[model samples]
Target: MTALSIYQQHDRLLVAVDCIIFGFDGQQLKALLIKRSFEPEINKWSLMGGFVQQDESVDAAAVRVLQQLTGLENIYMEQLGCYGEVDRDPAGRVVSIPYFALIKIDEHEEELLEKFNAKWYALDKVPKLIFDHNRMMNQAIERLQLKASTQPIGFELLPEKFTLTQLQNLYEAIFESSFDKRNFTRKINSLGILQKLDEKEKVSSRKGAFYYLFDRDKYNKLQHEIKKFI
Candidate 1:
């Protein structure tokens, strides 16, 4: 058989991309979910997703899906994995590549969310999702926890400047566990990748916590010296 003839022998499968977007709301980690508009499971909660277009790469498709719902670009996203179980999607023979994204909760465009009938649910409180999305979410959470421990990626979900208390809160939200305030602060201080400012966040207390910015330059240099953040 000719190479072209041999290539035509196999069955065709659809390729799709799903985005598992995580955000921090100062207390808990949340994921953005949309009400599916198409049938097979119309109106059901699902991860933001779409079929990969003929002209676009999987990465571009994921970015388009995320931006359609969040109205933001230049997001911090990473591929979680691929799901190709035969019956994972009752709709058809579709393979989905899921990407996990971290976004600052306060920065997303509210109008875009309203347009898509989307909602943000705390990770622990997320409702059952369509198809194998729950499985994808569980895996994304595991991957995020691993990434957060080894890299300073968590800063992507926080404001440009935040208090130590807020920083600890973000870590606790990601890990779903509490840390000793003093110890957490000490550990973060020891890293020397934070630039402390005179400005303080007084809304939380009478004696407010000073704000600090993540020093990306310092973090880049510190990466070679240290292996983990928590």
Candidate 2:
């Protein structure tokens, strides 16, 4: 047989992409879960996912899944890993690549979420999911924690301009622990990746905390030499 015929001789397995979507709502880290529309496990909580099309790459499939479910594009996403256990999917022999995405909580389209029966659950309170999705969620959280410490990726979950308190709250939510205010502030300032503005957020206090913007340009310049966030 020809080379093309030889490759086609093997059994075919399906491939799918699942997204563990993460967001921050000022106080806690949240995950977006949808009620599965169809399957052996219909109406069950699951991560947003779809089968990879023949014409598209896995990365493209992931982006398509997120945009279709959330109606938001240009998101911050990273591949977590692949899961290819013999029976991970009950319906078929399918290999799944899971990706973790960070999105601003308020930026997602509300109508799309409602259409998909999607809801944001605090990471600590996420209910049991269908298939191996619960395992996917746990792995995504672990990856986010590691990424947060070594990189400034947590900012992707926050608003464009945020107070230091808001910034700390996000980190605390990700790590599921509290941080000392003085130490956190000192470390943040030393990075020199933030631009402090004269504007202040007065909602939480009379004195008000100043707002700061993450300077991507500055961070890009200093990324090689920057210290761990925690």
Candidate 3:
């Protein structure tokens, strides 16, 4: 029998990938969500997702879904986990692979987002998501927290240059707690992965805070090194 024929006796189920796109807009941590356009839960808030095609891997499918909604490519994404409860999807038996992506909020294309009815919702203010998405989001957040503590992945959410306050705010938003200013600054300085620029961000205040950029060279060299920020 052919390979396809050999699996004829086995059950066939749809495989889907759901993306939890996280963004930090200087002040708050947000998630990209879309209002479902098709049944079985039309008009409800949901994570952007699509069924995997025969020719594509789940990773490719996840990237496609993220690109379709945000018109972005080469984003920082990671597979959160798999959700395979037999009846998780009401329309059919769909096994879902969830991914969490960190993106700069200001970098997404507005037109593409509008096309998908996509909007950024603060983590605390997000509406009830369809399917097992709420669970998926919670898991993603936990994973993000763990990853941010050890990795510099959180830098993906900020702009190319940011102030120390903005960086501190991003962490506070992620962990839902405030940090002591002195200690937080000291910890970040200890990493030595940021390059302080002469220019300042004047938008937040008249005096403005000096801008700092992530030193990719230093970061790459220190990838194996772990530092605790939380």
Candidate 4:
């Protein structure tokens, strides 16, 4: 065997990137899904992803796919995990690098998602995914929960100025349970990440609750503190 062929065969691997795109409309959390147009999973609903080209970096490949699907850049995304089970991908032996990205519904490049033939579905209403993509999404959700526990990444899915009720809704969705109103407010207030505004939102209540804005820069610079409410 040729020396190069031997080495290449010994180390050959398939690299793929899966994007878990998260979005939040005014009420519910959503995700962008693309109808698979490739072999092995044609027509299936899948995350925006692709095999990494020989000349591209993992991050570069993810950006390209995200851009092609969302038409936006500089969104919040981090490496979620790796899925390397021998049969994770049915097409062949492949390892996938997963990333979870967050974009506010108002900020999502709707035109781009449309042109790419992608649709946004609520997180709870997401359709079945191809291969191990569902596992990738679960891992991404865990990553988001961890960060949300200590950081202000939750704000990435919220509006610039939102109501306390809206903030609670985001938290409740992540926690997957209803929270006591008094305790929830107290705990969130203790974090000092929000700046209450003078305006009020009349959509959900008649009393018109005041609006608030999360201070992301300050929240990030602050130390990680765990504060839970019943």
Give TM-scores for every candidate, taking all chains together and pairing residue i with residue i: 0.98, 0.98, 0.96, 0.87
The clash number for model 2 is 0
Worst 10 residues of 1 by lDDT: 221-230
Candidate 1, RMSD to the unseen true structure: 0.9
Q: Name the TM-score of candidate 2.
A: 0.98
lDDT against the true structure, per candidate, is 0.94, 0.95, 0.93, 0.82
TM for candidate 4 is: 0.87
Candidate 4 residue-wise lDDT, 57-143, digit = tens: 999989888877877888788987688999887788999999999887777677877776799888788889999888888888888
Structure candidate 2, residue pairs in collision: none
TM-score, cand. 1 vs. native:
0.98
Query: What is the model-wide C-alpha lDDT for candidate 4?
Result: 0.82
User: lDDT value for candidate 3?
Assistant: 0.93
Q: Which 10 consecutive residues of model 4 have the lowest summed lDDT? A: 221-230
RMSD of 3: 1.3
Pick by lDDT: which candidate is best? 2
Q: Model 1, 105: alpha-carbon shift in Å?
A: 0.7
